[model samples]
Target chain A: MTSQSAAVLKKKSDRKKMGMKARENVYQGILWIFLIVLALTMILPFLYVVILSFTDSTAYQAGKLILWPEKWSTEAYQLILSGDGFMNALKSTLFITVIGTPLSVIINAGLAYMLSKPIPGKGFFNKYVMFTMLFSAGMVPNFMNIKQLGLIDNYFAMILPSLCGAWTIMVMRSFFQSLPVDLEEAAKIDGCGPLKIFARIVIPLSKPMLATMTLFAFVSYWNMYFNCVMYITSTAKQTLQVYVQKVVLSSTVSDVVDLSMDLATTVPQEVMRMAAVVVVVLPILIIYPFLQKYFQSGMMVGAVKG
Target chain B: MAKKKVKYKATNKTLRQQIYEFRWIYFLGIPGLIILLLMNYMPMRNLIMAFQDYNPHLGILKSPWVGLEHFQTLFQDDKFYNMLKNTLIISGLSLLTFPAPVILALIMNEVRNAKFKKFIQTSVYLPHFLSWAIVASLTFFLLSTEQGFVNKVAEMMGNEPTAYLFSSKWIYVIIVVQSLWKSVGWGSIVYLAAIAGIDQSLYEAAKMDGANRFQCMWKITLPSIMPTVMVMLILRMGTIISVDFEQVFLMNNAMVKQQLEVFEVYIYNNSIASGSTQYSYTTAIGIFKSVINTGLVLLTNWITNRKGYEGVM
Candidate 1:
């Protein structure tokens, strides 16, 4: 009787273990499917943009939203790049990004580095900087100030107001503080002044951080639109975002349509709009690999506890 | 005793010499300070334009202050409540989505495959770096009546195409979904970091006690990241009033203009539309928005503290 009971008990425990393994497999299956679907949702939109831009009218009509292009063509790209609209916007964006990024990095790094030191009035100055992050001067007032400063219709208007954001300064300061105290002391004993220490020791040690900041600042400047719209009134000075937006949006074409009408009208407008978007953002994709590598590390650095 | 005396003398000398030695650092900081003064602090005093009939010709110095005049205008305007409603709905819907990142992070943590996890992260984060213009344009292609993929799909299916953009029904959904698409992966970064910081030994103990993987995730991992989740939720309350001006402005068209008008856009429209802005009135609206946002943040922070979570402030 005891042997029979033990056999039944053993069978019950075996079945329970099997059930647990089965449930685990089910959970794993669902989790994998969910993640893959989420990733596709992110990726497919971009792929669709690229494919639609390259796909000719015949392929697109056949609903060729496949992973690879069929009836692939460069007509849309040629049409977009051929236009004066794209070129002018490209120039304006280049000017904004190229000039704005280095200036932002240098000024922010300078202020942040100094503020990181044990200087007189450090607390007051740090708080003064932090206050700007919390309280802003409002849109109308800021516009009025820009007008008063005679920056209307000027490119500097786009660059100057955004130069020293309080968040960047704070993050940069924390990075500076995290550096070894011994490195700075050693530099001092070697008879290096503040400028020398900054230019030589600090800049070299934090090359990766600086590179990340530069790329981030570059992306932000490249993507700048609100200031561009507010400050730049002329069509000639309009940045890529505003320009691309005008072409892509509006079911009925705006007058800029004439500027972009170099291509045959037979080409689908969707292709043209998609091409315009892809062309404008192509730089981002090219640098995407580098951005992916550094951005995560840079974000982790910024996450250091205050 | 002698060493202590030497240290005291060294301090007295170092105080004056340190300031003198670091003059370049002080000098280096001047340009940033000037820019800060010019850009941030300089415009702040103009906030008083809320009270006055601000005239550009006479400027802030000469505009006569009519106390509470603009405030009265703001309260009485029909557009005010509409803008308020849009703000609440957009922000409220977004608040409903705040847990999305935490959920994503938790699920991601369960994945033992590092390569697959990285691929998922890199793909989803692609949208975050793109400008609002690009995203809006994407929306135009996918949802716009003329060239949208949705309309095309509908037409092929022998159904009438929906004008998603021209209707108010899809406005909140469009805005919030786009925001989530753009930010959900980016937002998960914080929570993923929080999860990484959780003590691994707790999971081991749970496993020893015969807990299943799912149970360990819920009972150990979720509880460990609660403080971060609470702090983030509290901080998110502060942004309820300040909807993305860029998003709303880019998305605005003639059909749904009334439905989409938020405070910042309204201020922008009032300034640039007729070419003669009621600066004081807009400034009053700005101040009102800021005050409410500040209040919301403080209230949420206080509540979080009372609940014994970490304080955001």
Candidate 2:
């Protein structure tokens, strides 16, 4: 009788274990479904914009929306690209991003390298940068200072004011400090000076950090909006983002259609807006994958140390 | 002891001499220092405009002193109070979204499939790189009443199309949703890093004790990343007054202006966009924002220290 009862109890425990395994499977399945749905929410909007940009005007007006367009057309891209406004704005944006990013990286890296060394007044310099990070001069005062410098309505307005960012300097400084002092000492023992060590030894080893900083500066310059609106009063000088804003906000479908009627071709306002978005976003999207490898390590350095 | 005193004096002399030796290093920093002075410090000195009438013709130095008149005007303006209220409400709504990224990070952590996890991360990080202008345009395309994707979905469900941007009731909801969409994925990155740093031995032991995945996450992972979450929360709290100016500016329209005008927009409209400039009054408002921001930072830092978490400062 005791052996028979023990066998029954063992069977019951085995069944319970099977039940728990099934429950775990169900739990994981639910979690997967939830995450995929969340990711779809992120992705579908961009997909919609891309699909809508390709859809012909007639189909779009008929409300025939799908993941893929039934009748694809390049009319929207042609119209926007042909426009003087779009081309001019694109040129301005490219110029700023290309020129300004390198300039910023150089200045910030130099200042950071200086700060990282155990030089005289290093503590004072560190405090100076930190204070700017914590406090700001407010919008009006900064605007006033820019005006006083006669940078209003100038391209230099975009580049000059943003040259030295305290946060970027801090990040670069931390990265510099993380390097081995022995390497620098060795370079100095071999008759290398400060500038020589910085140019040859320091820079070559700091490529990943410099690349990340450069990417950040590039992105910010490309996305310049508020500064352009405040500083560049001329329509010809406005960057792509500001111009896109003007187009998206000020124009309607009927207005675009009427304008297009004169040119013997019809461009829907929706399609034009989507095309503008693609144009503004395309450069970043193209370059992102190349620079992505540095992002994880770069962010680690910034977050862990800073 | 006498010999040690001489050595200390020798070191003091070397320190001063070192400054002269490293003069070139200081020169390397000079350009950046000058730029900071021109851009950051100069503006701070221009905060004196807050107390003056600040006429462009008279210049900053010659502008008549208004004393507390700008402050008095700010205190009495009905629009100022309304804008303040709206700013607080918007900021409060955004603060509610602070945990979204943390939750997302935790969810991502649970996925055992490495490839799928990476795909989701890459896809989600796409939005962070898009400009606010593009985001606003996308929002309009997806939410507009006439032919928006959302409206089409609603129509298929036998519901009337909703024009979200035009409705005052829906503007804040739209703003909050847009902010979440833009930031959640990018923000998760830091938390994911923190989670990655957790000891794998703890998870192994949890499994030894028969803890399920959810149980392991709750009992082990969440508690492990609590300090990171607290630090991020404190930093966010410090900027409670400042909304994303570009997002607010681009999303705002005449119809939604009443509900959407935060301090940033208010400052722009009064001082920059308006035909008549109220430089002093606007400067006063800016000062008030700075003070409140600094105070909040100190307050949160003090509270965090009291709670035994590391303070951000």
Candidate 3:
């Protein structure tokens, strides 16, 4: 009688274990569905924009959401590229990004290197940089200062005002500090001066960090909006982001299209806006996958050290 | 002992010589120092404009000081109070959304499939790199009344289209939602790192004790990252007055400007866009914002420090 009761109890426990397994499976399935929905939310908007850029204007105006256009056209792309509004903005953006990024990296690297070493007055310099991080002069005064310097309507307004970033300097300084001190000591024994060691030894080993900083500076300069709005009054000198803002947000899209009437291809304003977005975002998207690996490490290092 | 003292004196002499030798290193830093002085410190000095009747021609040094005039005007102005209210509401909503990314990271951490995890991570992080202009355009395209995707979906569901962007009723919701969409994925990264730092043995032990997955997560993971969450929250509190200026500027229109006008927009309008030289008044508002931000940060730091978490000093 005791053996038979024990077998029945064992069967009951087995059923309970099965019930828990089923519940766990359901929970896991629900989580998967939620994550997939979230992933779609992130990806679909970008994909939709791309699709709309290529969709026929009439079809888009007909109120159909185009995930994949039945008929794709390159008219919007042609319109954007042919127009002086976008092309000029593109040129200005490229010029600033090319010139400003290297200039910023060099300045930041120099300051960061100085802060990394056991130099006299290092504490004072560190405090100076940190103070800037903590406080900022308001927009009016900064604008007034820039105007006094005669940088209004000039490319220097874009490049010079943002040449050195305290955060980037600190990141680079931490990176420098992390390197083995034995190498620098060895270089010192070989009679290499501070500048020589920095140029020849320290820099060579810091290519990854340099790339990360350069990419950061490039992106910041490429996406400069407010400064251009505040400083650059000329149509020819404005960056892509500001121009995109004008065309997309303001009532200037019709004006831009009218000014570009010489172009044979005519795309609707909506399509043209999406095309502009694609153009502005394409460069970053292309380079992102390659630089993404480096960026993750760089970000971790910066966050941990800072 | 006498010999050691003589050697220490010789080393002190070399330390001074080392300072002289590193002059070139300091030379490399000079340009940065000058730029910082011009760009950062100069404007800090110009904060005095908040106390003066600033004139462009008269310049900062020559401007006559009017103590408490701007502050008194700021306190008296209804528009200033409205802007402060709007700023607080929008930022308060943002503060409420701070834990969203933490929750997302926790959810993502539970997923066992590697491929699915990678896809979610890669897709979600894509938005962070996009400029606010692009985001604004996308938001408009997706939320606009006439031909927006959301309206289209609503129409399909037999509902009338809603003018979301133009309606003041929806502005706060739009701002907070857009901010979350843009940052939630990127913000999860640090929390994920913190979670990864947790010991696997704890999980194993919990499981051995017949604890369920949810129980293990609650009893272990969340507590382990509380300090990181606290630090991030404090830092975010420090910038509560400052909204994303570009996003606000892009989305703002005559229809919703009353609701969307925050401190940054107010400053821009009075000074740059308005073509008015109300520099002193705007500077006063700016100073007010900075003081509040600093106070909030210090207050949070003190509170967190008392709780024995590392504060972001």
State the lDDT of candidate 3 residue by residue for A1-306, as single tens digits.
999999999999999999998998898899999988998988888888888889776555545555677778988887788788888898899989999999899888999999998776687899898777777787887887788788889998888878987888888898899999999899999999888999998999999889877877887898898899898989998999988777776554656533466543345677788888888999988877766676346454354324
Whole-model Cα lDDT per candidate? 0.82, 0.82, 0.82
Clash pairs for candidate 1: none
Q: What value does the lDDT take at residue A283 in candidate 2?
A: 90
Docking class of 2: medium
The candidate 3 chain A region of ten consecutive residues with least summed lDDT is: A297-306
TM-score per prediction, in order, is: 0.91, 0.92, 0.91
Model 2 residue runs over 4 Å out of place are A1-24, A62-67, A252-265, A298-306, B1-16, B156-158, B302-308, B311-313
lDDT of 3 at B39: 88
Judged by DockQ cut-offs, the docking class of candidate 3 is medium
Error of 2 at A202 (Å): 1.7
| Candidate 2 chain B, poorest ten consecutive residues by summed lDDT | B1-10
In angstroms, how far off is A105's CA in candidate 2? 1.3
Q: Against the true structure, what is model 1's DockQ?
A: 0.52
Backbone steric clashes in candidate 3, count: 0
Q: Using alpha carbons, what is the TM-score of model 3?
A: 0.91
Candidate 1 stretches greater than 4 Å from native = A1-23, A57-70, A251-264, A295-306, B1-10, B13-18, B295-313
DockQ for all models, in order? 0.52, 0.55, 0.54
The residue-level lDDT of candidate 3 at A56 comes to 72
